[model samples]
Target chain A: MRMRFDKELEMLNGEIEKMGNLITTAIETSVKALVNQDMTLVRIVNALEMEIDEMEKTIEQHCMTLLVQQQPVASDLRLIEAALKLITDMERIGDNAEDIAEITKFFGNKTFINKLVHIPQMAEATISMVKRSVTAFVTKDKELALQVCYDDDIVDNLFLTVKNYLIDLIRQDVNNGEQAIDLLMIAKYFERIGDHAQNIAEWVIFAVTGEHMNTDNIGKTK
Target chain B: MRMRFDKELEMLNGEIEKMGNLITTAIETSVKALVNQDMTLVRIVNALEMEIDEMEKTIEQHCMTLLVQQQPVASDLRLIEAALKLITDMERIGDNAEDIAEITKFFGNKTFINKLVHIPQMAEATISMVKRSVTAFVTKDKELALQVCYDDDIVDNLFLTVKNYLIDLIRQDVNNGEQAIDLLMIAKYFERIGDHAQNIAEWVIFAVTGEHMNTDNIGKTK
Candidate 1:
């Protein structure tokens, strides 16, 4: 019975892995659409959102069934529950991508002042973090999870850079403020997506070690 | 045994209620800080964030213990699971309030093109949604839970109004861009807090009915 339960638990992980892959794909399409100004890709990402959400609900249901049928305990139970929580974060990461696509719709034919410099780099960094956060879950590597937290500092610095840069742009010309402000929001949403990815890495640590890992790193013994 | 278990669940709910109350207070303070531009309240909200993080961890630990000890089935298990998920959304909502406070710090000692009329109203709507979302769980009131979903729509419409209003502000003068962007982000954060609050309300509905509530009406149905 326990072996059967293990397969089921493993299947739960597989489903999450698949969901993570779709989210990554969604992010890719969203960025492509935004960068290339392709409304087609944005529309696809929008339509695919329902699929991603359906996958999320399916994974949550599977996790619940495991808890009920297997009565998971110790690390196993935590892992399943962590998957439940992590998937929500992962799903919202997808939502942020959709938000980006929606923002692209608002921009229409306008050119961003920076010519898409920071946003794409931010997306690249964010997708890297998303990949490693989930990889940390599959491997249960605390160091990898910790790296995810540290890498988030880079994202924060990026957010500050983009915000200050936009502020400077608007201050210099004042008339260019319209495009700059939209780009600023686009950057802000990307930064927030990175933060959610960090949240998933934290959940991976919680699952493996039975501890809550706050990004603030307070109240810990060094 | 069941009586003892019920008592344990009550303790868990009581603990969450305290955290809920803290968050409500935080929202109240953050908005005051925002409107009054009170640095002291901003710092207070920032400092209290650690306590909320600690409370989240404490609740997670307690929930795990109950899950392991009680081996709760069906409704019992679902209730604890819902609490676990609830704490997460609650914690993120707390973080959103803190983000708003942080935005207040960024505003410094300046007034802008657009007035700050809608933000306090948005904050109040989110806080009420959160308070009632948790109450829906405690009282198992599907009616109230569903009502929270409608309330989420109010915030969404408010977001649309704010977004369009800010967009027009950008188009009109464009000089107000930086300040407009800041206000827009602050508004966006409050809108997201509303989303998370709506998420809690959905969880409450799931816990009560053992089925996911429809989120189709999220920004529209109300």
Candidate 2:
């Protein structure tokens, strides 16, 4: 027989899923703000973060309430804990998105020699990780959650590429140094978002399999 | 009547307190490595992180065991859940310390002239927050935990000052742009650590008081 609190647990999951979607939107708007150099969208992402922060608080309280009232066992309990843990990652990702947007506003009509490649690639991969990780939560699929861990490697590689690109650009021409460094930091913010997404995926897998992940067990997924 | 799982919970707290000590050591070693340019110390911090990570896993499992075995109610159960959440924050603080050390290694005898008052000040405030927050946890003192929220403002002010300083430093000297920018990123990392500390304190408060802290009450801590 199902417990009465299952509906509240379901409600908690729905709220977390909504937070994930908002985070994805924030990342897209933020990265687009940078890649497309849209100051207007940058400001919008900035303003939108307060609402996300408020949502985080609300969802957190809900999770706490469920934990206290439901006294969930096994997977249900893990799901509540995972949702609680995942919110900080999502909130921090929203913050990194805002940081990237802020850095983008610094370049005023400055033309770069090349198109932004790795950054958008990084953003796309991050979005994929976020989407799939949350899906892993919704479906409780350990396999897909484990896959997101491997996906983080791609994000890490992109970070190295972006880092090297900025370093080479700065070394070649010292005059464009400021913008190049800012671009490097922007790359870092995106990479951090990927890290947070990996963290979420790890919690998803943990919720299902009772395992924790790090670089040591990169491909340890079954 | 003495509860059997209370012993398990005590062991869990012991592990958490041990991890807290490890973080204190990590913070010291990571900073020593940063200020003294000791690569060996940094490597030690990096290596010890695996142990901390494993400790988190083991403690989490222990929490799960207690929850499943005892089916604890209210405050006792809150303690276990609090331990579970505290471990994540503790581990992430370790990660942040490692990041600071890792970034410090990127510099090679390159001189930085900034007074850098804010980074260390921020670290101090954060350390205070972490200690006080955990003290609140151990003592179940809601007021002290609330004080940590107020202390977060000091760290935020330091971050803002550092940001303004970096902007002025970059605008004043084109040559100092790169190093100053790197310093800003480092400052950002420290500011984030402070944020995490504040987060831990908020958890401590919530676990005790059953009230989600109001940001409106954040500044007026008595």
Please write out the lDDT profile of model 2 over residues B60-130, one tens digit for every residue. 77876666556677777677767777778888888888888777778645566575567777677777777
lDDT of 2 at B199: 70
Highest DockQ model number: 1
Candidate 1, superposed: residue stretches over 4 Å from native: A109-114, A168-178, A217-222, B110-115, B164-175, B216-222
TM-scores of chain B, in order:
0.95, 0.90
Question: Per-residue lDDT for A96-188 in model 2, tens only?
Answer: 888888777877457864689998999999999999988888888888887888888788889878866765665565555556667777888
Query: What's every prediction's RMSD, in angstroms?
Result: 3.3, 4.7
Candidate DockQ scores, in order: 0.37, 0.21
Scored against the true structure, residue B89 in model 1 reaches a CA lDDT of: 86
DockQ (model 2, Cα)? 0.21
* Candidate 2 Cα misplacement greater than 4 A, ranges: A3-13, A35-77, A101-117, A167-182, A215-222, B1-15, B62-83, B104-122, B153-184, B214-222
List, residue by residue over B5-36, the lDDT tens digit for candidate 1: 98998898899898888888888888899899
Maximum-TM-score candidate: 1
